[model samples]
Target: MPHLHGRVAAQESVFARMSRLAAQRGAVNLGQGFPGTAPPAFLLDAARGALGRFDQYAPPAGLPALRDALGADLGVDGADVTVTCGATEALHLLALALLGPGDEALMLEPVFDVYLPQVALAGATGVTVPLTLDAARGWQFNLGALAGAVTPRTRALLLNSPFNPTGTVFTEEELAGIVALARQHDLWIISDEVYDELYFGPRPTPLRILAPERTFTVGSAGKRLEATGWRVGWIAAPPGVTPGVLGLRQITSFSAPAPLQAAVAAALPVARDAGFYDGLRAGYAARMTRLASGLRDLGATVFEPRGTYFLTALHPHWTADSLLDAGVAVIPGEAFYARHAAPAGLTRWAFCKSDAEIELALTRLAARPELTDV
Candidate 1:
């Protein structure tokens, strides 16, 4: 067999492997960040309606109806949108369109693991600026370090608000700083707003308002609507970036799945359902509080999350020499970073589980000394 070129090890996904292991062991899945629920009922009915009626392929860009709805939500026009299979495809397509050899892509460390491999696959140098969490206060961005990481070779900066893994939410002011820096350097800004709807605090406004031309915002119905299986996500770019993204998307995926697109399109009008979203946010917030309080009760220091569906903690006492084991499974913080690797006792637990699941996991963690403090 011939060896394939451009195969980067960084492209390998550990989350999938971990998820498979969890399934095989019948372990709770805190490793993977997927919702465990169905989408809106109206959306499902809409998809059913579209089936057979619209079984054929959609336009290469996307369904005209969906694009229009998305445009209204994003405060952009239909001409500026291109729907992809999911935010994953949208991210990949954007990478293909925006990055090339010698161009450096800058992002925060302790970031999404996908960024490393995707950037490498794009034939671009990846520069990661670390976002260290302060225990005294909530996890915060190291702004000075972030600014210093930007340079002449930097082509794009990827920012994820309501960030995954750490759950650090970016403020409007922080986004303003990022926009200012991008403008100063003429860099493209790729903002992943997949978790924008999962916020526990005031929702961060879109950075698109600052520099619409330079910003590419990625949104997902999977995350917002609890329909991961539906796999409907879109990229909202300016008119200029849309052409490039459309060019890449055609060959990558001519169009999103028709039935799923229909479902997503139907769901868009009420994605931010006040009653549903408010309750959902409150539910996750309660889960977070429970998990954090439980960890503290067990004498572990917890890193509080302001947004997103995760809670991270530090087990400083459980070093390589003095290992303390929590019987429950979690993703190690190191999994999300490229440098200054997260140390032993540093673990991440997801709060997206139901109250019962959360209580069970906490009990399992607290009662089982055999699993920790080696």
Candidate 2:
């Protein structure tokens, strides 16, 4: 038997904790970030058909059709694609393949919870730079602070734009600043872009598009297609990362489900088009307005989002324990940060659910003021 490193040792994840409490209270859950509704009709229908076809193990990389469709969408080739169970698995494989004991990966504060754990479990230190939100810059952070955080040990930069919890879209200037640093230090970048198509304004640009030579972009069928349970995702990397990512993927996942891959292949082109993505943004925008306005009316601080399906609220007296007791389940802002303390007290609520679900949750929330109780 071997002893696990302290970084790799963990308790229950934030998702499990909030989900379990939500179940127990029968509360209207805005904690879990997945959609409460079914995927689009075409994707679901494709999934059903996929069940009847290739029931065996999928190809190690992915179904050729799915890879080809993704390549066409991303402007990459099939050979550079490495499909995995989900974006989560893809990140894990990349971490294992790239990081060593002394390596460091820099991720933003108020960051995604999934990144730190994966980086830590891979025997690498996960460093943090903070992104703060206020009335002025919205969710933007100081580029100087980020630049100062890097060191010689920093081997990579982990990015999740259209960021979760904050919903801040990294502007072209911000990306350029980060790219300059990476180019200076010769750092690899692994981006979490699962919400790439869920923008509320102008289309978001990907890091790979800017610096394909040193970038690996990971995305999934879950967010845009509303198929979280399907767990089909792909990593499109530059040729430099081709060998390690492809080989390590086989060891971790072996193969993602053939049927889900087929279904995602059918769904990719639909999700790739501008009209479909715009419709998605429209739907989420309506819900965002509904929830963010309600929170503001309730006298809670709300940072409205530019992209992604999350709504973040800040209040002094919020906590996971208190929110669960108040019958509206949400994840605390503290859950998202690993190194730096959250700039203020906050909570994140998922607005990806049905309209009725979002309404019901907000209504229940309005009846209770315990969320702001100090």
Q: Which candidate is the best by lDDT?
A: 2
Q: CA lDDT of each candidate? A: 0.77, 0.84
Top candidate on TM-score is 2
How does model 1 fare in lDDT?
Answer: 0.77
Write candidate 1's Cα lDDT for 1-374 as tens digits.
96676473344465776566667665666656775455667777888888886678988788898899899888898889899888988888888789998898889878787786788888898898887666687577977787798877889998888788788888777878888888889999899988877887787788788889899999998887777777788999977668877878889879889877877777778655546678778877888898789878767788887778888888755431122133244676777777666645677777776677678766766675643343
> Candidate 1: which stretches are off by over 4 Å?
6-12, 317-327, 370-374
Worst 10 residues of 2 by lDDT: 365-374
Against the hidden reference, what TM-scores do the models get? 0.92, 0.95
What is candidate 1's TM-score against the reference?
A: 0.92
What is the Å distance of residue 307 in model 2 from its true position? Answer: 1.2
